[model samples]
Target: MRNPSLAPPINRGLILRDFPKAEDTPTVQDTNENDTNWVALMVRVRDQRDKTAFAALFTHFAPRIKGFLINSGADAPLAEECAQDVMTTLWHKAAQFDPARASVATWIFTIARNRRIDMLRRQRRPEPDDLTWGPAPEPDQADVLALQQETASLSVAMAALPAPQRDLIEKAYFKDLSQSEIAKITGLPLGTIKSRLRLALDRLRHAMK
Candidate 1:
């Protein structure tokens, strides 16, 4: 459904040139920080409202998100505006970023993707007095029941995981923590966290079967 014609030329050099040099950005190797050290910047923004950290995030993600929006049908200017709005939302909602649930890139892109979709929908919305509306369809009871059953099954599977794995899964799915946040909370290496999560999910899939 995306309008690829609106996409701009994706030049990594152009995008990276606008951000701080790689040496200036925090890295896992330079410090004892985990692979998701970039998320620590987000946490700093959340706890201290650190403008420097926010600027770093904006510098890194804003251009990428603009490209994403443009690829999704927005004009280049509109994409730039939406990207700024997305960064503004990140600034205001920093406390809500959860590392256990998603990586920083995934979380930011999800926001961008959803915002772009919403903008598109609003642009296409009918006028209040437009008479083309009809009653909405009723909910499907059978489908609802099936979804409920799946939820129950998933709960049981989650309960069967090791406590640590269960805790991560709960934070990711229920509390909506990002992977970096989970790493911070659990003091686990990012690789270890990912491996454990993979193992846990494998068990969950088998349980579902």
Candidate 2:
């Protein structure tokens, strides 16, 4: 849990993009340059001991990691705690990331996902796949199975999404990441991330349809 006073100030001026924003056309980038960059960055951190580069990655992804958890339904404190864990793990395990196995967004999202699961350790039951962390509602077995199926379908759909489309969504929805966060992570202009996100959402809508 995060100290009430120590939370990084979330920018109120910031507005999160809607998911499946276009929902009419889901298009993947031919390749994710961000992933390519992360691969190189990971290698640099692991092999050369570049604190600057590693720190850059941490600064860029931390907020996105926080946003992703909040968007996934964690409260403010839990989200902040989760983000710290993600960054700490990244610092320790830079060598573990391989672009060949996953895109940057995919890999980070997986980490956040796993971290969220770990948080459930102290809870009596792991939160349902639906990820609602409020009061425990007794869901029937059929409802539970349906929720699992939905998560599985979304998970598969998430993997199949094109890099460009998925990138925006991952930063936005999965990471509850913002345009600014996306900009920082990929070193793209804010306008570029926003406009591109609109297009990507459209493509995702189409593909997921």
Candidate 3:
């Protein structure tokens, strides 16, 4: 259940009265004093259960989170719901936030991305009644051979990638990590992560073709 006090307001101006616009707020890449301030707010929320601190955090982040989700292909209503859920989780998991490993924006946005993925998975999941409770049919030999060939080709392509690019690709696709998360783990700039991933994927595509 979500806390009523933390619920998103009907009017944006009502909640954002004193805070900066979403665009004006510091981003995950911004390593400024504001990041320290946000970390302090998180500490307040965690230790004091201070609604004022939580409200400040919410005002700064909620809209940005919603916009991120919408940009990622969620509709307005779904983005709103996911933003609310993310804020609520922030309140509950405030103690788990580690300032050393990630910025406040990074941690919060990672939660939003993960929540969006979970929602997508749930939407695509088949209902229990939709399952066919019977033995599966035998595979067509031609289809099996093609699948095996494709698998081998992919393995070869992956192995051929430069070590740096290949590591990022594996962390991204196989580990299901967001680019920001990958940047954190590898201690690389976000742009570097994206660039290497693009080059690696291009090479893999060319190889498979």
lDDT at 96, model 2: 55
Q: Least lDDT summed over 10 consecutive residues: which range in candidate 2?
A: 130-139
Per candidate, the number of residue pairs that clash is 10, 17, 0
lDDT by residue (tens digit), candidate 1, 1-209: 76876887554321212333334434413322322455667767877999998998888889988887776668998999999999999888776554433446656866776687678776532324511222112223343233233323333333444566656644553344877766544432233335544643454346446
TM-score of predicted structure 2: 0.44
Q: For residues 122-151, write the lDDT of model 2, one tens digit per residue.
A: 433354352123212232334323322333
CA error at residue 100 for candidate 3, angstroms: 1.3
Q: Give candidate 3 misplaced runs (Cα > 4 Å).
A: 1-31, 123-209
Q: After aligning candidate 2 to the native by TM-score, how far in Å is the CA of 126 from where it should be?
A: 13
C-alpha lDDT values of all predictions: 0.56, 0.55, 0.59
Task: Tell me the TM-score of each prediction against the true structure.
Answer: 0.45, 0.44, 0.47
Stretches > 4 Å off in candidate 1: 1-35, 123-209
Could you tell which candidate, 1 or 2, scores higher by TM-score?
1
lDDT of 1: 0.56
Output the number of the TM-score-best candidate. Answer: 3
